[model samples]
Target: MSRENTLLSASNGGPKQSPVRSNSSDGEKSARQRSQTPKVEFETERVELKKSIKFSGALAILLGNLGGASIFIAPTTILSLTGSPGLAVLMWCVGGLVTLSIAVSVCELALLLPRAGGPYIYTLQVFGNIPGFIILWGFVIFIGFPSWALAAYTGALYMLSLVYPDCPPPESAVKLLAAWLLVGLVALNCTYTSYVTKLQGFFTMAKASAMLIIIISALTTVTSDHTQENLKHFMDNSNTDFGRLCLSVFAGYFSYGGWQIITVLMEEVQNPVKDVPRALVSAMLIAIFLFVLTNMAFYMVLTPNEALQSDAIAMTFGRRLHASLPYLLAILVTLCCIGSVNVVVMGQPRILYAAACLGHMPRLFAMLHYKFLTPWPATFTMFLGALYMLLSGTVALLINYISLYVCIMLLVLLLALLHLRYSHPDREQPFKVPIPVLIVQVILTFALISVSVYEKPHELGFCLLILASAIPVYIVFIYWSNKPRAFVHLVDSFTDFIRKLFLLELPTTYINNHR
Candidate 1:
């Protein structure tokens, strides 16, 4: 068997679903039905994706989340949060370590499952469909789309900042333009999904390289002129408590959120069980180092006050250094941003495809372009969703609601890990989350609580409310479509209670090696 087929056979828990013919009474899924989602009958060509590409270490971490905006803005904001160059880098180091803990946890779950939909797939198989669906849609519309919009908007504004640093533009127009750009991004996603990894690789390399240059330049040229000598004295729980700072860093951290978008397409990855961890860890390290180094560089060049007030922090350094460099940095930043945008454009549609495969959505989404071997319809739909978000003006507040979904997905993934630990004890998976891993998960959960507890109350409330809204959507669209009132009628609402309480586990199949 070919490697691709072997990977598919192993990755897919069962045979692909196909349209059933009434005459053929064979007890099996049909190939035709398995080929496409039943909902949309758009023409598709199956094109196989390349799986040989490999990314190592921090690049993998960077691959998951670091996008256009982080390089442009995160360093300055982090520094401003500290109000001191020395302390800002320190916080980045600390935050990177903390974020890695979560990455490690995600890696643990991802390797074991090695499927698409990342946290959503893990959760659905473990907890059940309800929780999984919530996380899945939460990511699809809320977290994933909004983040892309925010990134795109940030990229555009960053681009604008290059030409007109003095223009005090209102936030409203920025969002509408972002929304239009989101439509463009969605259209870009219609191109192809498989090749996007390479694009991201290039983006990752370019962004890191340019930032590194800036860092080196800053370090070489930085004198005590800009460094606040007594700024460290003010680093305390005064401006915002330690807890709030940590949680709000979620805003900062969102910049690095897309690295795992790769895992959402685990089925397409070559040797995912092995590669995924390597990618996650490597990406995290690179992002961590770059984040720390970049912050230090920014401090060397711009004071915390300067960094915070200016959106074009990198550009600030470039403008002071040379005439062409700011635009040059913007060029690289735009490419990096575009690359990240392409990466998301590649990822979310597959999650939608996964949902379709699970029968939670129309099956046409599962269809692959015969020519491209990619899920075109699913990809396009996600592109549209992202466009809508881009059109929305609440980029800053909007993304947090998205993060809440991302967090919920993480929560569900933990439950998935908990479930798989028991349900398929002897599965052929090579990786396992050890007992100590669980201990770390508990600690991470506590940390999330600490962050969420003392974090901005208003943002927290909004996220919760949005999450709550998914319950009805799930019932109306997914549940009603699958089986209306099936749960409530079956067990006098006990079934409903179990589903809500335990989450509905809807694995791809119970069969083994059936693909």
Candidate 2:
């Protein structure tokens, strides 16, 4: 038999079909067996991801992703929308609370399902293949890639600004740098999956340290004279721009965006049942505390106008403390963005791999590298999508596009939790969120989408276009059950070629077993 068939058969739990010729000497056959034994054993043993991420690593990932450069950059947008330091601060608080509630609800789903793909898996398990496809579809095109692009874009912009303090950097330069950052990080993820936890730990520490310095510096500068002055006009510019305000809240929540990412990696997390919840809650609380303080510090140090007009809020705030602080702040914020991109690189491809394992995607994506055990095909595919977005789209446009669908999907995932509770009451739920919290989340999420879409029909129309585009693709590739033999041959040949080229193989844990 052929090599592909032999590996496939072994992975499928069938007896190994050794290609031993009858005319071959016994000595040659024995040598072949010796060479093959270790490989077959390796493939069979490492079917699932290794549980390498401990509690600290999990916390680092959640915090690193949540406390990305958004805290440094998003304050400007929020302050602009609210037009008041106090209300802007309030918006951050509200966003954090809402996100925390969403994370709690997701915790139940993560524990119950306890697999890769995070929200994608939760939706797939409860809602079946088509709805699952929609979630995965939105994630790949809308949520996942755009997030990486935005971080890279933000990072590149800040880095360039540091280099050219006198003039704005050219757009081409920014895009080029962003592309390089994305490529390098993707390569790191593909090459060294085991090192991700270490990277996350270091990045999270740098982020926390940077935020702390800013917060302490600002607080020390605050005194009785300016304290009352800052507080007196806290609500001075607050007004009702209902639509833009919703977008501001969206921005605030965007800062807290990646809290759910660890769920996708639960399979790789050690002590997932206990550690997942701990890491999520702890990271969120710390993020909220620091984010709110950081914004407060910005307002206290600079006037509302100064805070709004400045391109880099953290840099501006840092410069007040010392002339050289902006340079340091720029470097730290750039690292924060890189860390966020790293989290995305490490987590998002697992969604594609999980989908492929379930037959929702091409089988090639499901294959793991023979030696590294990383999902190289899915990782590289995601890298290409993110690179395209980085080169093509701007920061503001990507934010609007990503936030709407993410809210919609969060709403769906919460609804799925409720559905699972009702439908599978007898199911073993290691964690249970209060129904009221879920209900409130549903209401708030729906209201956010409704108001934003209502006020901005143009953005809503564009988002709907991207969303509806998935259905036709689904019908053609996934929904259709029949295909000509030639098409089947073509697909199989392509899958085989890529598998052999990359030294990839299917995992022993197939989709049928998952269901």
Candidate 3:
């Protein structure tokens, strides 16, 4: 006390020694430090995904993603659920609008972040690490891997259908072909990024043209009286089953899925903020028109009962034109499936690479082919997962699992958008979805989730169980361990050997500098 008094006396010029001012200065300094932490982390951890995708490339990816085998299979399902051609058509329109609205919201977020992980990156940035990790896990397991497997399986099935028009192929044969297809696609993607995008562009153009020709030819040519009778019952919803109608909308929405593929490649696009939104909107518009017209063409050719009865609606529609047309359509459907598989193979690995760079997974996944700059390790992981699905012969079950998770993830994404608006108000937003539109998106998202839960509670529960399994993974790999483990090191060595064997280029610097 005597020493303190003497020190105070030495500063007697400020006899009022204000503790309040000193405390306030300390608080300000601490606040500044806290604010700068995230800024520093963001600067240090900024991962750079190659910006090679141009406007045309982006558009091609979007179109390729939207025009998958869904177009060939989903129309009949929608018609079956609605029990009326008119309502089914209306459901497609409504589904498109809902998808477009969600896309608009996603476009806003993509502009803000413009990163590689799509919703994973968005949710992580807006909410935090755990939420992002959860979404990433769900995406890789549910959407990405299952989609690749399903496409490959369906493509193989269609290929076999062409080989054996009268009889179905053996399940073992289908599985083998599907596994081979998955491998081939993975190899193509690992070779060169530009080549893959070009392939996608070509596929999009060819498929769109083929669909247009089919639509126009079908609409122009008159069908039998039975087909006309189907059209006459277009409005007859005597059953008026609301649950079935909701399921029809769900099917339509499923067909309208994959529009978010553009967002996942945000960092790859040349002008992500401008081009991504344009590509998304334009692709969805084209898809909506094509889907509705194709359904109209289906009604033009076959009765509702016939459409419901047929396993392959597109082939049936084509058969109406000519006897040989069904085979051609089957081949076309196979091509569509291949294109879809290729698109997923191209896009999904980046999410894994992005996760790895963020320290959510092994850093080996973050490795890029030095010359091609493709994420080969991540691509290989996806290939392995798809191959497992093919071998397990659970393509349908995997698809059902994916559907529930898709709805859940979309809901998470929409919530992320809203949270970003409130939490990151000052963040640069080159494009912003209006609040009202976001609200509508929220409503639609909830409705979709509700339908999924109500219609398939057991499936949803199973998905939740699978998602819960990620908790232990997160606890061990991400939370408990900061350093790479033995298996991770083994994977790294294997990747290195592959690189040397394949004559792939080596990194010029520490690849994980961003980490």
Tens-digit lDDT track of model 2 for 1-515:
24564566476665565667889866988887777766655545564566788899899899999846777875677787888898898888888987898988989888999889887888889988778888888888777878888888888998897889768899999999999998898888877877977987887877887888898887787675665687778889795687777777777666678887898888889899899999999999998998998888888888898887887788778777798888888888888888888998999899998888888898888888766778899999988888877877744565667778888889999999999888888887667888887888899888888887877778878887877887888888977879788998999999889988877767766534544
TM-score of candidate 2 on Cα atoms, chains taken together:
0.90
Per-residue lDDT tens digits for candidate 1, residues 1-515, read 22333234333343443435688856454555445433122211112333534554224324535644566655555554555566566666766665666667677777776666677787787778887777776676666766677667776665665566567456666666565666665655555544455556676676777777788777666455444443343343334457546654554445456666766767766777677777777777777788777766666566556667765678777876778877778777766666666667666677877776676765455545433456666766666666665665555557546555555566556656766767777776655657676666656655664576465567667767777788998887667745647653664355334423422221222111124
The order of the candidates by lDDT, greatest first, is: 2, 3, 1
Clashes of each: 42, 0, 0
Error of 3 at 308 (Å): 1.5
Candidate 1 similarity to native, TM-score: 0.76
Arrange candidates by TM-score, descending. 2, 3, 1
Winning candidate number (TM-score): 2
**Candidate lDDT (C-alpha), each:** 0.61, 0.82, 0.76
Every candidate's CA RMSD: 9.3, 3.8, 13.2
lDDT of residue 173 for candidate 2:
99
The lowest-lDDT stretch of 10 consecutive residues in candidate 3 is 1-10
- Positional deviation of 445 in candidate 2, in angstroms? 1.6
For each candidate, what TM-score against the reference?
Answer: 0.76, 0.90, 0.85
lDDT of 3 by residue, 1-515 (tens): 12332233334332232223444645776676465455433322222456778989988888888847777765576777777788878888887877787778778877877778788988888878877888898898888878888889888988998888878899899989998999888888887778888888777776686688678777666566765676777778733677776676667667788887887877788887678878888888988888888888887777777788877777777777788877877777787788889889988888887787777877667666644677887888889888887788665676767656777888888888888888878777776788788877788768877877888788878888878888788888789855567876887688667655543332222244442
Estimate candidate 2's alpha-carbon lDDT, on a 0 to 1 scale. Answer: 0.82
